[model samples]
Target: MPTFTALTTLADGEKARALAESMEEMDPTPDGVGVFEMEDGSGLWEVGGYFTEAPDEVALSLLAAAYGARPFAVSELPDTDWVAKVRRELVPVQAGRFFVYGSHDADKVPEDCVPLLIEAAMAFGTGHHGTTLGCLRALDRLMNAGIEARNVADIGCGTAVLAMAAAHVWPRPVLASDIDPVAVEVAEANAAVNGLSEKVICVEAAGFDHPTLAAAAPFDLVFANILKGPLIDLAPSMAESTAKGGHVILSGLLVEQAEEVIAVYSAAGYSLAHREDIVDWSTLTMRRE
Candidate 1:
């Protein structure tokens, strides 16, 4: 497959969603931006966000229409070389002591992470975003605190990044869940790569929806890295699945969005523990009181 990106200077507005849904046929936007890649030879198109100062409708639509005028040049990838390119493009990053690497980058990742290489094609939590980094750091804090959790859940598992981190952080059994099946597949592969297949369970479900999550009873720790709206909506699920005195780590919200998310948990008897800010994103560690 060849990917071409389209750049659009559509500032923060309702137009953003409209522009995104317009290109739904092409490919789903990645990283929650106006960015979309051509799944086939269609070529990559990234709507590079325009400056907020972009001119009125006439100019905006003109640029938007013009991008499609030129042939999107698609790059050819050799089947054998795909792994090498993904690793080079999305370099493995280390947050605190946790490491994020592509399945192909397993050999390149520092030995400390126990190296879990999720396949290159896997989307979502590829470990490139601040949300993933923030989550890793938050997970590390739990390990550093010496909190022992026999049961853990990583909701919205997104490539099972947090679940893989949890397996490395503790000897406990961790259950990973994501609404996307591809994420589940990659997560399962990652678990095996990290030598944690036996310790971590990957499921195709949403926010602890699987029977294993239910069978495990209330978990000692839970990790959720979904957006503010979904996070708030699923607050009850997380609260219910967490043991009375266990803990929950929340991420994937902006600094301004944290208060509302925190409010949801705080009302449910979770007392805040530590707050980590990476870029403008925030992740909070809270314990069930």
Candidate 2:
């Protein structure tokens, strides 16, 4: 069966959400509708829907016009085994001391590296993306510097790879949280796959809001590989959650956005210790004063 997708973008989030809500009433209703803020600092929101049957272009055009959005770009997507395609295309990624691979590539893991098994699926962060890779390398750098953390948290953890990495090195229970329930589920599953289920606890929460995260406050280290806006919003909570002289490794930022993020964290009493630029993304390591 073929699937169809209709996408449009608008400047206003409220308008975008309204369009997404209205999509539910259309003929040949969408199987799923989503409204998301674009991460490029453009302040635009994207409204998209997936349909089992081809969506009505007239309806989409009318909705776009009503919302002052760009004309919907509708596309037909052939039914393909995306997971299988991902497995074939995603080779093992080595970042510092961490070796991330899917089960299919298990034979490639080196004896000296810390192996993290993350299947290529719906969740993000498999250590292939520069953001995830940079965080792993930053963690490795801390380990190499003789820094030992007994308590750790991975906020916005996608696959819990970083949390597992910390657990692998320190043998301590690490808290991993994500706003998306699916990501949290994936994180927990990945932890189990990596045999770090006991060492890494997964939770679904936005930033540090959950009771699990709050109870485990003043963490010795925290890894947040989320974007600049959330990273900035998380500065105060991160500062409060981190122990004095504790470390925080952050990524999911464009190279140009790093300075603003650095400034925010600096104002929150953190000093930049190290920075790595992997392609267009920048990863930062900072210490709480």
Candidate 3:
């Protein structure tokens, strides 16, 4: 079956959400509607709808005008085997000491690297994206420096790959938390697949808001591969949750925005230790003072 999508962006988040809500009531109503803030620090909200049938473009245009948004770009998605495509295209990624691969590429893992199994169809942070890859490399650097972390936390952990990596190197339980319940579930499943189920504890929470993460506060190492805004918002909490002299590895930022994030964390009592840039993304490793 063919699928269709209609998407647009608006500067106002409330208006974008209202537009998405209205799209749910349209004829040939969307199977799903979503509103999300753009992660690039654009201050724009994206509103989108997915449909089994083609959406009415005129109606979408009118709705966009009503919401003061750009015209919706409607497109029909091809009926393709996404999983097969992913399996064929998503090759194994090697970041320093870690190797992230799907089960289909199980035989490709090199003997010298630590293996982390995350299916291509699973949640984000598969180590394919630059942000996740940078974080993995940052962790590898810390390990090479002989840093021993007794407690670690992976905030906004999509598939718990970072948490699992920490568990693989350190003989300690690592806390992994995400705001999305589905992501938390995927994280748990990935942990099990990596045989780190006991070592990587997954939870559903935003930032450090959960009791389990709070109780496990003062982490020796922290990973937050989320976007720029959330990273800024998380600095104070990150400072509080991280132990003095502990390290926090952060990514999901454009190269231009890395300076801004560095400033925020610096104000929160963190000093930049190392930075690596992959393509257009930047990953920062900072030490809590």
Candidate 3 regions off by >4 Å?
39-42
lDDT of 3 by residue, 82-175 (tens): 8788888888999999999999999999999999998877836788899999999999999899998999999999889999999999998999
lDDT winner between 1 and 2, please give it: 2
Q: Record all residue pairs in model 3 with backbone atoms less than 3 Å apart, i.e. clashing.
A: none
TM-score of every prediction relative to native: 0.70, 0.95, 0.95
TM-score of 1: 0.70
lDDT at 58 for candidate 2?
96
- lDDT, candidates in the order shown: 0.70, 0.92, 0.92
Model 3 residue 164 CA deviation in Å: 1.0
Candidate 1 lDDT tens digits, 17-49: 555555443323332235433222233334443
For 1-289, candidate 2 gives per-residue lDDT tens digits of: 8999999999998888899999999999999999887878788999999999999999999999998999999999989988999999889999988999988898999999999888877436888899999999999999999999999999999889999999999977999999988889888899887888888999999999999999989998999999888899999999999999999999999998999999999999999999999999999999999
